[model samples]
Target: MTGELREAAEPTRSEGATYYGRPVIKEPVWKVPDVPAYLYLGGMAGAAALMAAGAGLTGRPGLARAGRVSSGIGATASVAFLVHDLGRPLRFLNMLRVFKPTSPLSVGSWVLAPFSALAGAGAVSAATGLLPRLGWLSSSAAAVLAPAMTTYTAVLLADTAVPAWHEPYRELPFVFAGSAVASAAGLGVVAAPAAQAGPARRMAVAGSALEVAATRRMQRRAGMVGEVFGQGRAGRLLRTAEALVVAGSVTALLARRSRIAAVASGLCLTGAGLATRFGIFEAGHASARDPRYTVEPQRLRSR
Candidate 1:
């Protein structure tokens, strides 16, 4: 009984409250989860802007009108979701008070403000039929902002302390861009007639190609935290994503003439995009829950 009491008196590794002797390695943090919602909406807006540019260039006024309307709606909706998630909507004005290149949220906010304005203008012009005169200007602006909108979400997420998200920074932007393009293409197919949806199909092909490449690189390059991509729920979702995207790409390319094939590919692309987004969210949360991801990397970097 005395020997057992001595063993119990010794401190085990678990006796320390926090990792490494620090009382508080990190404070209790709560970030707004709706940021991703804004990201998804912003991606849609970017794609819509690109579609508007293409439709205007192709001389399809009706398609252009649709694209403008879609872009405007997407941008407005993103802002609404962002504010709704902010906990205090009035504080949103502070986001516009300064320009901070180092701050992704600030930069994205400013970028979205103007992009939304331009998109709104394009939509109104299309509705009022004034875009014929200002087509070049609006199209030029939208084209420039389209890629940024498709990609900035990567920076936005990486700015957070989430291990899975931060470690895979190199590939996330491409993955997001690819997914955005695919989603945009899918939206195009749904909104426009088969003939006008040609560009959307092309976008899907390009986007899927990029997404596959980026996702593969992420799995290969991220060492440990990226391992989540191949484990548990994340692994299942990513595998399903790859299969669907590949099948959809093949179907779209080989079955171009078949409406059924086009529809199938579009649906697959949409599903893949959704899966990737949700999978990423889940993976980040998983990484955050484990202390190793947060501490080990920082220790190595400091050393």
Candidate 2:
């Protein structure tokens, strides 16, 4: 999450009005560790839930067990990170007291609550063989809720005034969704038996391709505002992520014959997914530090 802030140079006379190099939007108070961890884990949990559902329907018991366990672990960890970010656990509980359609956090709180419970139930069933029927129902419910849980955070961030986040709102969900798929597939590849790992490897390849494409498109459409993604620590991390994703996807295609290759591919995709989350977080900070990103876009629109 390291990022070096490089302020924009003074605007030329031709460049519309300036605001004394001051930020128009307040920088996010969210810390690096908590929010990014929440993002990554939530994505992983959501995708894992989907994988669990798929494995159940297809009669792949080994993959289904792997998915259930991963979903539960990821969902639990994501909540811990979120509560840590809030500084007080009660703040998250309070968010669930009311439902506000206009508020992503409010909606997300509702989403996470049921999903977490269901994920936990699924895991318990897998572990203790208790309430098998209940576990099936819970896993089904979680699979239905997973997509919203995964993408709502992107909408939450995009709802903000942060220049980097808000500008590419349309693509952010896809970016998050693809990352989640890759992460879950990575876990599946590593944990499931080789015979049942075929679908996971294919998913890893597809998700990696989608993530890379969507991310590049987001940066391209963001214009100068996206410069944060191309410089400093953010840039380095993103480049590394892209490389890993590409390599992992290729290796996954060849993993059917080699256990070692499957492990290697899984590690690569997992690392890439985590790196993408951190890179995006660092890029947001970089965008906020530069006043030009805040003011220039509005100046153009008004003209």
TM per prediction: 0.83, 0.93
| Clash total of candidate 2 | 0
lDDT of 1 at 209: 93
Tell me how candidate 1 scores on lDDT. 0.75
Candidate closest to the true structure, highest lDDT: 2
* Clash totals for all candidate models: 0, 0
Every candidate's lDDT: 0.75, 0.87
- Residue 94 displacement (Å), model 1: 1.7
Candidate 2 pairs with clashing backbones: none
Model 2, 190-299: lDDT tens digits are 89888998889888988998899999999988877888888898899899889988888888877778888888888998899889999888888888877788888787
Itemize residue pairs with steric clashes in candidate 1.
none
Q: What is the Cα-based lDDT of residue 190 in candidate 2?
A: 84
